[model samples]
Each structure stands twice: as structure tokens, then as C-alpha cells.
Target: MKPGAVYFMANRKNGAIYTGVTSDLIKRVYQHRNGLVDGFTKDHDCKKLVWFEMFDDLEEARRREVQIKKWKRHWKIKRIEEHNPDWDDLWFDIVK
Candidate 1:
């Protein structure tokens, strides 16, 4: 089975965040960055890939996405900042 990923995008550090699950992380992140996918991320301008977690099981990624979505804003922020204190836009690394 193909691997899947749960990723979070932000407009900036401590800014609006959007969590999503995708089978192709690189493609999905590209779409979000270019505003190709409509809805919350586009509306909120959350194009920065601040955090992501890969899973061999698509179901696991989807479940994690749902759990993170239900989490408080601060908890999410803390999680992101823990691995990515800088909240760097990881798009560059994954893109090329």
C-alpha cells in the first residue's frame, strides 16, 4: 500500500493552521501552496508547510488528522514548535 501523510500548513508562526491527510504529500503541498485546492487553506492563506507526519497506512494518517483537528490551538502550536521551532516552510526540501 502507498504511504500517506498528515500535514499542517500555516500562514505563519502562530498563525492560522490547517490539517490535512494526503497520499502524496509533495503533490498536496504543492497544490496548497499554489491555492489549487479550494476551501479553508486557500481562504485562510495557510500555504506554509510547518509540520508533517508520514504513515504507511492511509487510515492512520486520516485518523491523526482528525485527532489533530480536534485539538486545541495551543496544543497544536506546541506540537509543531517542538519538532519545528522555526516553523520553516518545508516545501523547498520536499519539492526538490
Candidate 2:
């Protein structure tokens, strides 16, 4: 359906932070949660879905993802705060 750049905030409970962009959020997150995908996320246990932005264009989403990747930690936190001020784990919200 919609092309999106979804980033996950990985942590047991408000712990580690992980940012990622994916076209398919559901499948991607499932893999992260299940530890099917190895690397930074799996090693750090960063499975909290915090903030995500949807874009109709894949190019736009990719552009945003790249931009975010270069952003400073505070900048990323500020961006996330725009929607999730409390930084609550947004895992269940997406499924509903």
C-alpha cells in the first residue's frame, strides 16, 4: 500500500534506540521482534517501535531515511518528540 520509512526504537522498556526504514513495516518489525534479523538490532535488543512517518513516494521515504541517518542524536529525539513526546513504545498502536 503506502511506502514508508519506519524506524524502531529498540529497548526492553524505554532502553536502546534503533532506527530503520522499511517498505513493509509489519514484516520488518516482526523479524526484529523475533530476532530473525541479526546485527545491531538483535545484538542490542532494540525492538521498540517508537516513531514512523509514511510517505506516498518511495523516493521521498528513502530521502527521509537518509536524512535521518545523518541527524544528530538530539535532532532525532526532537523529531520523535513531535509525535511521541513520552517516547512510549508504539508497537501495538500500529497493529490497530
Candidate 3:
């Protein structure tokens, strides 16, 4: 199978922003949701999956992650709003 990567944004139950990359989107997100991962997300309660982009190539995904990381807070908010105007958590939507 070709490698796939996802860059996702999470906010504290309703605050802050956390960006992350994962080859296994579902599992990684699950870890964050349950506080199984350490550092940023866990401490900040950044479990909501506000936005994500998928890529077939790891390098492309990495590049996108770097770009997003460097973006201004307003740009990131705009990016998320474009795809998820409501800023709703998308985790449950995927499994259904």
C-alpha cells in the first residue's frame, strides 16, 4: 500500500491549537483523544479534529505540515474555516 499522511488541527476542548502529522490518521487521532500521547496535545486538551489534509506522499505531507506550522494564526484559522466553518470535531464522522 502507498504511504499516506494526514496533518490535523486540534483545539482545547474549545481553546488553543495543536497541529500534528500521522501516517495512521485514525490511530494517531485516537491516541490524542484518549490522552495516550505525551507533550502538547495531552497537556492542552487538544482533542478536537478541526481540520486535516491527506497526501499520498510523505514528503508532500511533511512539506505541508511545515508550511502550516509557519502560517500566522489568522491564516490557520482561515484555512480551517474554509473547510470547517463550524470548527466541529470530525473524528466520529470518519468511522461512520
- How many clashing pairs per prediction, in order? 0, 2, 0
lDDT of 3 at 91: 90
Tens-digit lDDT track of model 2 for 1-96: 457765856575346678888887877887888889899889998777778887877678888888888887777777777888787777788778
Higher-lDDT candidate of 1 and 2: 1
lDDT of 3 by residue, 2-91 (tens): 455655547642358887777778888889899999998888888888888888876777778888889887887887888888888889
Question: Which 10-residue span in candidate 1 carries the lowest summed lDDT?
Answer: 87-96
Of 2 and 3, the candidate ahead on lDDT is 3
The superposed Cα distance between candidate 2 and the true structure at residue 87, in angstroms, equals 1.8
Best-matching candidate per lDDT: 1
How should the candidates be ordered by lDDT, best one leading? 1, 3, 2
TM-score of the candidate numbered 2? 0.85
Report the poorest 10 consecutive residues by lDDT, candidate 2: 6-15
RMSD of each: 0.9, 2.1, 1.9
lDDT of 3: 0.78
Steric clash pairs (candidate 1): none
